[model samples]
Target: MGRSDVRPSRSSPLAWGVLGLWLLVVVLALPLAGQLGESTEDEGVDYLPASAESTEVARLTELLPGGDTTDLLLVAQRPGGLTAEDRALVERRLERIDALFDVAAGDPAAAGVVSGDGGTALHPFSLGELGEEEQGQAVGEIRELIADPPQGLTLALGGPGALGVDAEAVFESIDVTLMLATAGIVAVLLVLTYRSPLLWLLPLFAVGVAAVAAMALVNGLVSWFDLTVTTMSSSIMTVLIFGAGTDYALLLVARYREELRRLPGAGEAMAAALRGCGPALLASSGTVSLGLLCLTFADLNSSSGLGPVGAVGVLCALAVMVTLLPALLVLLGRRVFWPLVPRHGESRATGRDTFFARLGSSISRRPVTVLVGGTLLLGALALGTFRLPGPLAEQDNFTETPASVRAMELVADAFPERSGQPIAVLADADHAQEVREAALATDGVAEAEAGREGGGWREIQVFATDPPESEGEQATVDALRERLAELPEAKALVGGPTAQTMDLADTASHDQRLVIPLVLTVVLLVLAVLLRALVAPLLLLAAVVASWGAAMGLGGLVFGPVLGFEGLDAQVPLLSFVFCVALGVDYGIFLMHRMREEALNGADTRTAALDALRTTGGVIASAGVVLAATFCVLAGMPMVVMAEMGFVVAVGVLLDTFLVRTYLVTSASWLLGRRVWWPGPLGRRPAAPGQRAAVDAVPAGAGPRGDAG
Candidate 1:
């Protein structure tokens, strides 16, 4: 059944028809891109501090009046002094900007302009709870208005609007960078793997088609659900499409080379390769796609959005790899491996031995030495986790452009009160008065401003002296919630910068406690089914977990001591865990699959381990190198969070491929021998006829050419 003579039914015309239909659909969807280009509106307001000490006193008047909090701060500065003409020009420009967006009607004073110390001026624009896109546009227009500027005077837009604009730009760069990096890595890997330009181009073409389709589909889905397609969608798509598509191509081509050596013609070789490897490719892709789909359980909207879209890309890539790749390979034939076809009579052994195979052999010879040494190294690295720090700053989310950094520094300097801590407390509409009274009575609340009086529901702005995410901030939130609960008329909903920090912490804690175990359990079960051995899965999972802990610990150490941060970002653990586990499994799968094949073909346990590593190590190393390089590019991003993520993933990939997958997994397989698949029917001795057929088909080491000429 595994012979290269048998051919599966060919559906070339049907395959081409489907490809044509997919292209037609994409061509039709191109028009929708224009409609989707429109920006969204900001739905909330973010308040910044005023430079004047007396502004706080003035703020009290607005608070007493019961109006929405100021969400925009416009800063106008002029050298030397503000002349009468400069003041007039600044005021007129500020008024025009303020009029561009709708402001709350309750307090008209909230929409006015004010001047700062020296020749600088400030204007507070009322966002009236606009969406993100509107806020961005408003900021863009403000920027455009001040682009040329008048003599001696410069304008700087500060507030949530500016922040939104900065964030959007940063995210856009991240998307573009990730895509380009993934493409570059794939191109390099393909060139290295095939050493043939034509073969290298095949995977790229297949992935391109999958990528275009995946993007169009993802955008359509985002529109259908009114979901915010995360700024990371492109990164997610790049990883899925390129990684999975290239992986499939590698498997197909590797098998195709072997089959062509035995089969009479190119068509027979293609059929044989597809029949032998197609099912395995499908299974591997299915596992990965499902793993990514598990992210839908993430509480964060951004992560959840990635789940389905990433899954779609992976599935599409798999389809293209199986169908399109094979079609292309059949068309190219022996020319795909031209310029260096193996001499028919020569030994199949290539002089290029891999480092991983040598390392695996050394480990098999001394598992205890390898295991202990590896564990200690990992343990030392894991110590770094204790020193990891929290986010560097709130502005760390934005790009490190001069404007953004200057805006951040200016905001911090001019408005210490608005630097971090801000909260919004809401209560039942019917109990607005009672809730306001309760809130006013709460301790640690520096000031409270009531929101618009509408339908008996009330929202209040609470400014506290404590920094956001600090113990004091949580205390203020707790005290306010407790006070509001005692009021008969109000059920308090506390949410804002400080509240969001607390909520994120709480959500992360809950997810870590619940989601990790659930995901691990699922992964272990899947591994068990694939390996047909409970022991192997357990041990493999243990190795992966250790590697993950070590990676995090190392990240924490670098970020804390070298970078001088407090602790790791709250979300880092979850993100790292998911990425490490899923990608780590790919290495384990490759190694174990090769080992199983070797054992079934009559190699001894030790020999099989060596043979498996020798055959599969190059592929695994190439894949790991590409993945690590792609992830490492994230460090180039301006945001510290992205940099940390990039470093962590890069390290994890290296550790999994080099240390754990090459040494630990191979050593364990060698030790287990035939027992690796114990209790399964596969564990039994090979059938005589099967052994005879396998021996007749080909030797363990065969060249791509028929005879050793």
Candidate 2:
């Protein structure tokens, strides 16, 4: 009546129930995932900071006689000059487009905003009162019809409508590609780490459950709370769930394998493993989720929305990994490890496992040297920060030049004095003429003209003397804003493609100043409570921050000269910093938590630090590889900003896993000894000499929670 080693037991019911629940979650999420794309807003107004003047203008314009304005540019270029045939083709096509949709409202005269040069000309075709899906489709159809132009003419589309379609297309591909790449990376890494085909499948399935649950929960949050959910947030959340969920699984499964060496029953072994690592996993997830929530303070809707969505992902990963993963592993029993199986009462595997042990011993011999050397190296890498470029231009956004960017470039080349994108001034209709004159007189104004009047507001189109997003145009936009601000009676506000970019840059700078300190404080508090020590938390925070700076500095070097990038995205530093610290600290927690257990069990400082490294290093390395690979998937994306963010985060994680946690933190702890646990009872105790005490931390029949994971 003793428990059988291969017993069917109660695990059958638990396994089936867990699997069924997860399957149900996936089924529920499928429809929600399909609807998630609808939640994304990529319009120029969508990115504006709520308090920005442009946002007010956008809102007022939305409520005008037209619901919202969508601008599309139709450009036709001939290398030499447009012939009579090309001009005829252009006129016919422009009319055809206006006729295709009531969008332009039968206003052919309004569609004649063109470059002075006969070789390149772009018309301003405006539409209003359309849904986003409708707007994108309209752009797609225009692009299709504009093709097969006169043989010598080059046609391309840009402006609000075309840009939205291009952005949406990029994000659509990002979602499917990132998920498949992440899943493949995890599956391969898990197989390599476990060396057991069956063992890798359980965690993969468990993480899949976590991803589906996260999507469903996030959709629910968006629906119930009216929180914003962008296409960007949804895709990023998927990577987080897969990467973080697999990390939790690795920690739990590794501990379970170690426990199986002494415990006869799979249930007992798994339970013991969870008890050992559960608190650390919970606390680490807390740090990430709460740190993400700190982003709610951001003024930009897209950045703030990522806060709740990302937090939901990490929490869902924790739930599935802790519950479903353990159940499946127990159901599969010790055979999960296959030919490399651990058996009860067998000799432990010290026969050839000396990689991390040797590393620890080497550091133990010269702790000061390793600590000093690591700091200097990271500091040198940090120097690359000075090399980083400024705010990335919209033309540089795409990996391969899209037709939209190409059109903008061609317009720039052919029309040296005219801007490809114009500033749209919304002013009171009473002084619409005065506003047009004021815009025309502005210092950098190339030309200005009054357009439409509705809902007490009129549109004044102003062109800059320089190309869009160039310094001269930025000056002109500023002049327009300042001059327009003087007309209180007019209630003027300026916005357009260039203004949106400027506002995004300003908002990013503002959010970084606000969110960085808040995230640091939040993470520090979590570390303090989890580690239950003052000094250690401070030390850990310092190390993670150092790691992030080094990562960024390295990014600067590669991003500019090495990778041939012109500039970093305005949001790259803020986004990279948050992820590096929040996620990188997981490895630190794994290492230090194990060290804490050893110290609590009375191993001397040196022995405990070395023992912790020896036991936990492999799992930490594996987790780092999986996380790094997942983030690097963003590099393959068409957007340069995403590529930079991914590269920075991936590098930072590797630094955290191998250099900082493995060498620097380990060495620091070795030097600090029991003092590393300052104010803790363990910190006050004297050591009972060296190597022998490590062997006796958990004696005879004590539970596996005493030492593993």
Candidate 3:
């Protein structure tokens, strides 16, 4: 099967035309990224549930006096404790920060900057009605002023202002750092898988095109619609485009390579390749997209926004991989396969009867043992959830300790036992005096002061005896809210850092309860419809859910003890579940779709499972590695939440790839035999005319896709 069987590709200039048009589109849309950067929202309101109490408080506060208040903490500390000189240094820096901020915000000093216990200072800068850029510049200037303090006195910024600014800085870095990291990873994996220098670049180039297109599309949506773009969602979208796009590319390229062996011409081979695998790729992408869109019902706006953004990424990646990628391969002809290029009728290395072949045979030998053992292992790992970290605090958000976190630490030490942070209370101006008195009289209140009053509302700053986001402080807030509720005329709202954190944490919990079941239901329904077998879909979802639980259990053991996380980010479990289940179902589809194809073509159930594993082992494993590595790239990020999410997804993908898809699902398919495909005609029908028996008794764990790369 050499050149004798290889026919020349047709002179189809249309492929080149497609490439040219997409390139032109990319050129026109690339400039929108700059505008998108300015639009990357990381504000408190951006993350909260639309109708949550905290969201209302944030809104009401904006309506008061100047649009919004920029709370900033100026920390000054000395190792031995604060000295007179330290206090004076803090005062001077606060004055400088205030002046710079006032200039940027076009407002005079309103809330005075005062030191706490003479060790550090609280310079809560409340500004109104500034553009996002102006606010960023003001925060930047403030950060710079505190950049270097007087000798022996260290100054660091904290509060909502500092957190928002820092978050935006990380998001801005994604353009360069996260993208480069993802590309580097994909390149290495592709090189190892394809073993060709030039071959790897084609799929990578397609991913880049998809990424740009998706970003521009997202920017347009954000610019014109309710689609919100935050640092978290934007990052997740980038990962989806590269990771999932590459997954689709792997499947298409694998099929195209197979077609190249049998078909005469490259153009004809690509057409056949798309004909064979196009539905599976589109189905997988659709499954992921639908699962993500189900998040729209989520009460958490930030999480819900990711639904559409992620769906956009998958759809865009699908468009490029299916169209642009196939066009490129057709244009390049056999050269895309490089040194290992497939000649006609050579069967393209087949890579069957490898480690996975052996694994499938092993499962066939003792199906029940493998199934029970795998389930027990996963269940045991689930026990680690007992050791999982507690609720994440703002100070613990960073992978590396930032100055703000350090500043909070200093305040905690110097003002030991004082409400490490302030509690903000908003009440009607008519009942303002009463609210202030009530707050001061509260048992946890260390001090209370009246804040800016406007728009028929007044704010009161209540410094509690407990630290920020701590349970004790939570109790104080609850009490304050309850007391305020008694005065209906006050229309008091409890907000600020602590309140926002409480709301976010509670929302995450609620979203978990609501979104998880919906996500599972969505994925399962898609699988059932696609496979036409209720039992098979249930098995696939069960494996995915098990994988998620195992991944999180592993995360519980690793995050706090190994990664040094104090607690799992409230959002990690939900995000991880969404990713693991949605994408995990992908592997199941890859296997079952092929098995069903084989079964429908008249192969027996056992032969079909082995053949599916035999043929798909390489592509599935390669796809898994690409997706896992792309996610693992997030582990290097400075944010603890992103790191945890990355770890869990990486672990889950690998587990689903090597263990569940390869072993558990395959064994289940064999044990259930025809019953695995229950209610489907494929389950009841006999072999088709050309279908053959299982490949000659391959040893266990020897499928071609078993490289574990």
Candidate 4:
């Protein structure tokens, strides 16, 4: 791992070519910026439920008496009581809105309009189901029509269409917040890590190039394959780019510092740093990319989209880290660390047998004490797992927001049956009557509307008496679905607010059942190949699982009792499992790799474990701090899911870097002695002269307390 064996000269033409290609890709992707821009139009039609189940109901309704129609609920209020002028003005505006979308069948005044509570009026605009783009356009036209609205009349539009517009606006704000927060965190963390103005800028610049290039590449791929990017893609990019970029940057700079200590000149040090850290960076990036690729297995479109986009960002960051970062370092040389210089003729201290040195020694002396204490602490946290709750409904997703909370309150008061409940049932042409009859007979059905079609296929809409996410509501829907299934005429697909919640719950359950084992297997294979030892990966996997369970337990405590939320987000466990397992293995890899390297060089088991921690501990700690801070910013988002995710990831990374990798791995290696690498060739005594000499000087069972010479 030393600089002298693998250093690449700064003046090499190969390095410049790599840098040039990196710049070329970035420049090429700039043209696709328009494709990445989010839609800003607010449309009333976009707020309606457009799921497969909803669409079937709408299709069937088209054949009914009045025909299938979508209603736009226009709510208008005034400061005082309703006046003649206020009513007149609202009537005029409603007429205008109806005209904007050709709402009237023949006469313009035919559009349905109702005045409610004397002070407020509800204007219902009838439009059939509209596509997303069409709905966005319609909403924009409606907004423009009311732009110069009359005095004493304040208007707010709601329904399915309005919800869409509000969701888009909220999502946009979240995007901007996450981006700014991530950038601020990365900047501060890098500055603290390097304490050099120039070095601090390098990661930002590299990641910037990587991000731009990755997005452009993703855009091109999406266009070519006809893949749609979700509203959440930008947020995913923010996390992946910053997280991977920081990881890569840390590996490079840590190596750079080590090289500077070893080499006599800056050019040599820069070259050595790149060459030494290059393979490790590539290996790590590959693993992360592979881990993200696993997201393709997800049944949900949102999660699947994240897989490739996240993988692209990681791959791009790796390219920049290895090529552009190294070239820039070469060009800057010692000036990259201008204020901090290496003292001439100073030998870098391995720092083995320090405080952690004595700690590891003590743990090795009493392996049972260390193991028992760690297990008890983790197990205590695991007890909270039983209290974990299921996935929340769409309304519950925004339950923390003031507007949503207020809206829920109003619905509960005025329209309890309609409070956050929308259900749709679909059946084939022959079974429509039976299905509709069964649906109407179902208990807790507040209202059941039959479809227009007289043929076998008929769509039914059922409004439930309870909120969609409630257990009673779900049980009612499940019963209705089962009874409908028994009807001879229809083949039913049940979906709507309650159905979507159930679908998400099923998806999360399926993902956990499949993904956890898959990820663990992949990680084990990776560790096996990297360490060439079976016991190490097994122990490492155990520690990672323990950490994940502990994080879940802690999250349950926070969200369940402390925050007093119904339950933790359904996706929290999945997120914790993936991130904690994948990222936790990173620390394991860093530790075990260094330990193996030392052991191969002939150090005794105890000395090799201690020395490996001494060398890799600082970088691991710095990396954990940066990653933890970056994840912590998610707490500021409006959504409860984001807040819970942020907290868990932050805590998980801290435990992984500090507690597990530093103390646990080192102590386990020391206690296991030579058997740590058992059933592997490395477990056997080294045949090399250097290894024999190092091992003989440090004997096993030499009383874990010793001085570093």
Most lDDT-accurate candidate: 2
Instruction: Provide the TM-score for each candidate, comma-separated.
Output: 0.81, 0.92, 0.92, 0.84
Model 2 lowest lDDT segment of ten: 700-709
Instruction: Give the per-residue lDDT of model 1 (tens digit) for 1-709.
Output: 1332223224455455656765676587555533433322112121111122112222332343234333556565665656777667766776666566576432222323333445555555555655555666766776787677787776676665466567666765676677787788789878988888677888888887777767766677767876455545446556767876777777677777777666656667778878776655665676666666776676654555566877788888887778777776665556667654422233444333556555654665566667778778888888877777763345454334446445445544444443233477666667766776677678777777776544444667677656455567679888887776677446566766555555555656665776678668777777777767776677778888888889898887787677544445556677677777776777777677666666666664455667778777777777777667767776566556567766787788889988988877776665555566666544555433333111112223332111111
lDDT of 1 at 182: 79
lDDT of 2: 0.80
Candidate number that wins on lDDT, 3 or 4: 3
Which prediction has more favorable lDDT, 1 or 3?
A: 3
Tens digit of per-residue lDDT, candidate 2, span 461-482: 7899898888888888899999
Superposing every Cα of model 3 onto the true structure, what RMSD results? 4.2
Q: Indicate which candidate wins on TM-score.
A: 2
**RMSD for each of the candidates:** 7.9, 4.8, 4.2, 5.6
Q: Alpha carbon lDDT of residue 423, candidate 4?
A: 79
**lDDT measured at residue 614 in model 3 versus the true structure, 0 to 100:** 85
Model 4: per-residue Cα lDDT over 367-404, one tens digit each: 55676777788889878777666565565554254332
Pairs that clash in candidate 2 = none
Write model 3 residue lDDT over 1-709, tens digit each, in one string.
Answer: 5553334365578798889988997998798754666666777688887777778878887777765656566655666557766666666766666555553332222333334445455455455446666777877777776676667777777766666667766667766688899999998998898998788999999999998888888888898895778888888888999999999999989888888888778888899988888778877998899888988888787888989999999999999998888888888788667678888767444444577777777776676788899889889988888889888887788888766677678667666567667787888899999999988778777888887788888878888888777888888888888887888988888887778778888888888889888888888778888888899999999999999999999999999888899877877889889999999889899899998887777677778888899889889999999999999988778888899999999999999998899889987887677778778776666555555665544346533221011
* Candidate 2 residue 512 C-alpha distance from true site, Å: 1.5
Measured with C-alpha atoms, the lDDT of residue 701 in candidate 3 is: 52
